[model samples]
Every structure is written in structure tokens, then in C-alpha cells.
Target: MTTQPHFFIEDSLLYAEEFFAGLGKITRFSGRTVTADDIKDADYLLTRSTTKVNEALLYKCTKLKFVGTATAGYNHIDADYLAERNIEWAPAAGCNADAVADYVISSGLNLANKYGFALKDKKIAIVGVGQIGKRLTKRFAALGCEVVQFDPVRAELESAFTSASFADVLACDFITCHVPYVKSGKHTTHHMFDKQTLLKLKPETILINACRGEVINNADLVEVLTAGHDLRVVLDVFENEPEIEMALLPLLEFGTPHIAGHSLEGKARGTEILYQILCQRLELPVEIKLQDLLPAMAVDHMVLTEKYQLSQRQFRALMNLVYDIRNDDVDFRLGLAKSPDSFDSLRRNYSIRRELTSLKIYCDDTLYPTFTNLGFNTSLIKGE
Candidate 1:
């Protein structure tokens, strides 16, 4: 008889159990409460950001042979240590690109509408041109927005690609960050935004950070905003999360827990990726498909009878039907009102968030591109 793989999985990862059916001995644990003692006997560890898979947690976990995080960022994983132990590691990067792109678009639209600036005419600087940034670039270009992308790593990797100058980035009307959390070196992203850097931003600049909280210095931001600086901000991640700086809340245009990549499809995709990786490692034929695991959406289809207007309000209204970013802000504030410990609670009980692909829109050729670019599933009206 073949030896069965012992697996430890985080329960919050969507569809993980369904994908791993008949594959191994499964043990599910809450990321918040899982301990090294809990996973000591496991042959594999699959987790999300909440579970810190470092030497501290894994030193005693000798039986583990594989480790994977169903998340875009692997900053929580000690890859060097895993490699030293000869344990393989991988992250489901780009799994949440569509979801995050949706968040950025919705947030940008809100800011544009509130600030009286047309999105198509605004200049946007996107820091970190990774999967999420690339999607935002394509979508923003389709919307007629001028986007300046900057990623030093990508610039070095791709000879044809040129990263934008930092000065040019700071000069834009809007600056959004989607970089990973890098703590050391020339390209370090931690505390990239300080009092000086924050002050350097253009007046009325809409600054958005969805990637990581330390990306923007929270305390420095509080200082900047308190000192009468003008920076309209929207932040999804924060420093010292689950215990955020309460003073920073009132200063933000919209503040949320780290849920930018929390779309149902995104989470499922991340899990599916890890499952596929395990399948590959085991040399098993891949039989699972993401589409098969998803449920029928509540608001799955719509038809546009008239010509679609591309105003920020109209664009934002259409997005609102699928997801209202403002509601999250309201819920975030209210959750904090009820209890400071509600940050993770809100995330754990995060409502069903379907991506734009879940909603199919039938529109004429004149309006098809916009909807599709914004991540909607669109079909042209045949007779139109």
C-alpha cells in the first residue's frame, strides 16, 4: 500500500477540501489558532497569509515535505529556511489579479467622483507593475486614463520594459501601490512613504495602497494628515493589522481591512493553484477545474438597452451593482465601533464577493470594451 500524504490546510482557503479530495489525510485548522504542535506530524502544509509558516512554526514539523501559501504575497513564509530543510514552496501569485484590479478601479472611481476629476483625464501612477498592476494598466488604458507604471524588479527582468521615474510617479494626480512587502535593499518597499515622501506627493493627490500596509508609513501618514497636508487616501492593508492605528481611521477617505484580494474567485483560484502544484509534485493527472467548483451567482446577468455613458458616476454606479466599496468602508467603521477585535472577524465573515466575471452584461459594441475591461463578462447585442 502507498503511503498517504498527511496534509495541514487552512480552513479559510476556498474550495481547498473539494480540490484535495482523495489526495491525502487532511487536517483543517484556523490560521489564527494553528500552532507548530498542531502541524508537527503533517507531510504538507497549505495555508494563507494569516498562518506564519516560518522556522519558529516549522522547526519541529520535521515530517513536512511541501509548503504552499494560497496567497499572492509570500512575505510570511520563510523560503530560505524551507529550502534549507529541502521543503518545496510556492505562492499563488496573480490568483487575485482580477479581484484586486476591481478594488483599485472601484476606489479610483470613488475618488474621481468625489474630487470632481474625470477618470479618463486623470494621470495615475501605479507602483509595482506585477499581476495586479498589469491588469490595472490594461483596464485604465481602456478607460482612457494615463497610467505610469513603476516596478524596479520588472524593469531589471524585462529589457523592453522601462520603469517610470519616482519623481514622475509622485507628480501624478493619483498614486496607487500594489508592490510586495520588501524590507531590505535598494528596492525596499517598507516605509516607502514617510513624512517627506508623503509631503512630496502632488496636492490633492489620491493615494491608494492595497498591497501591504507598511508600504505606506501609517504613523507618518497620521502625522502628514494631521499637519495639514493634502493627501486623499484609501488603504486596504495597514501596519500592525488586527490592531490598527485608530487615529489613522478618521484621516482616510476609505480604510478597510486587507481584503483587496478576498474575492471568492480569487480565493478559490489560489487554492486551486496550490492543489495543482501538489498534483504536479505527486505526478498525478490534473482532473480539477475552477469553473466546476464555483456556484451560480445571484446577480449573474444583465442587458444594457441604451448607449453606455462613461462618466465616473455612471461607471461607479455599474460597479456598485456588483460591489459597493463604500459599504466596506461603512462596515469597517461600524465593526470597529462594536469592537476593536472585529478586524479579523469582518474578514472571517466577509460577505460573498463575486468578481466581475460572475456578472455577464449584454451591451452594444459601443459599450462592450468598457464593461469587459472593468472585469465584467460582456457579450455584444447581436442585433445592435
Candidate 2:
């Protein structure tokens, strides 16, 4: 037999090696270029961000029946071309929404507290209300804040939520962006928040970008900051990523290595969802065992109010002690700024982070209950 059906893995499939090892004739090609010739005899093609599937590639891979990308962004793949060729494609969507949202909410709330602002009374504006946006809205709303969202695609579905024009969202105290990349279109967010948009915000507003970097013009942002505009900026993504504008470094209130959604649970879930889709599309038995990351030890988190003497005022300090936003910023500046050659290496090998489950908050005399009420898991650090 001709080695049953061949499955080719291009780009790094974080946990795909183990998932495909049990199947027949699986070849792991990490970061290899996925050309037409490479997929000529292959029954399935697996890839991550690096590979792009289009007409040229499809015409070459006449035998390829399935394309599986273990990423949320499908813009790299030509979906229409694949459909015309009767080829199936699958991508993991919304798997990392909570993880991304957790990062945004935690960072936003933490930043607000740091700046002597009350989150409950603030108005938050969110653009591109997709999966990540919806999660962000919920978390912010949970904290007793009003969330105004803008997304033409979701205006009807999100009608229950406060809707607003883009300009209206810009007028809020805090603005968070979550639109995807669009090369060319009426809704192209290529430079949605350019110099003009940046100038529209109030001087005291907090500007956040967790979506694509190009969504905001880097030069315009730097110019605004240079001109004495003191908007607090938090960035988890940047244009020309891994090569952030050096001038913008000093302007950021919080910066990270784009690991906002790098939470252990979310990464594993993304892998699991991708694997299942691959199996179903290829008509094979899913043999991949999706292992959840090791859960963190629990501590008594109830007595937070009593043991730590924490009130709402101290919430920022508590979160900072546990998750330092500045540390991530420092690491990004140091790691990426050291040399340009190490950019790809640093990003691909970025550190693995724990979820909220990994944290351990301790307390005495029922302090655990109080911490849990405050939305923290504290059983690990506490001695039961």
C-alpha cells in the first residue's frame, strides 16, 4: 500500500506532533515552505501562521483534500479558492477569546486602578465587537461599567448592548480595539486610528490596542505622544510586530510580547479544536489526546479582606503583585530591542503563561471566601 494517506505538517503545530503520531504516515515539517509540489501526493496539509494557501498552491496540490490551520486568523488562506477546488479548510476560532479577553480586562482594570480611577463608574468603548470584543464587554460590564461597542458586522446581534458610532466610541474615557486586518475594503481598518483619530480622544483617555497592529498608525501615535499628548497607551500587538517602532517604547503604559492569549488553557484548547477539525475533515479517527495544562495549587483566598486587609482600593496592588504588567513591557523592550535578528526567535519561543487557575491566594480565618468573591482563585496558597 502507498503508505495509506499522507498528512503533512508545515509550520510549528505546538502540540500537533503527538496528535498526528498515532495516525498513519504523518510527516512533521516545521516551518517548511508549503508549496504545490510539497502537497502533490498529500491527502491533508496542516499549517500555522507562516503558510499561505491560495490558487498557486492549490493548483500544485491537486491531491490535497484538506487544509488545517491551527490559528484564529484565516486571512492567510484563500478560502474562496479552496472552496472552488472542492478542498476543505478549518481554523480554530473563539478558542482563545477568554484568554485574550482576560488579558484585556485584567490589564484595563489594573491600569484604571493604577491611575486613580474607579472602573465601576467609567465608560468603556470597544471597537470591532467580535468574539474577543463580546468577552471584553461582558467582563467590563461585570465590573459595573457601561460598555459601548461598535461593529457593523454585529450591530444586530449586539443590539442589546449599547451601540455607538465610531466617533462616539472614541469620545469615551477608555477605548479598546479588536478589529482584524483588512487589506482593502470599505471596512479596512488599515489605519482606522490614525493621527486624526488619535487627536479626537480626550487627553485623559486610555488608548488600547490588542488587535492587529496596523489598525493604528505607529508614526501618528508617536507624533501625538511627542506633541505632549499624554494618553495612556497599552499595546499587546503592534504594526510590523517583532519590530515595534523604537520611538513608541517610552509612550506605552503597558506593553507585552503578544502573549495576551498565550494562557496555557487557551493554547491547549486551540490545539485541541484544530486537531478535531483536522480529523473530521480528513475522515480519520481523532487519536489526539488533548491534555489540559497542570492546574495550579489552591490556597485559602476567602480571608483576603481580613488577612491582607484589602479593600477595593488595594485591588490594583494585589493584581500587580500577582501579575506584573510592567514586567511584560520591560521584557518586550529588552528582548526585541537587543537585536533585530532575534525577533522571530523571541516571538516563536515566547514564554508560556499560566491561566487565572495557576494563581494561589492565601488567607486565614475565612479569607479565601472573600478573595473568591472578588473573582480570584486562592485555594492553592492557603493551607486547608
What is the per-residue lDDT of model 1 for residues 214-284, given as tens digits with 9 covering 90 to 100? 99989999999999898899999999888889899899999888888789899899999998898999999
Clashing pairs in 1: none
lDDT of all predictions: 0.87, 0.72
How much does each candidate deviate from the true structure in C-alpha RMSD?
2.1, 4.4
- Give the least accurate 10-residue stretch of model 1, judged by summed lDDT: 306-315
lDDT of 2 by residue, 64-164 (tens): 87887777778789999888889988887876776677677667767776777788777899888887887777667756678898886566565665558
**Model 2, which residues run further than 4 Å from truth?**
1-4, 32-37, 55-59, 156-162, 279-323, 340-342, 357-384
TM-score of each: 0.92, 0.82
Q: Candidate 2, after superposition: displacement of residue 88 in Å?
A: 0.8
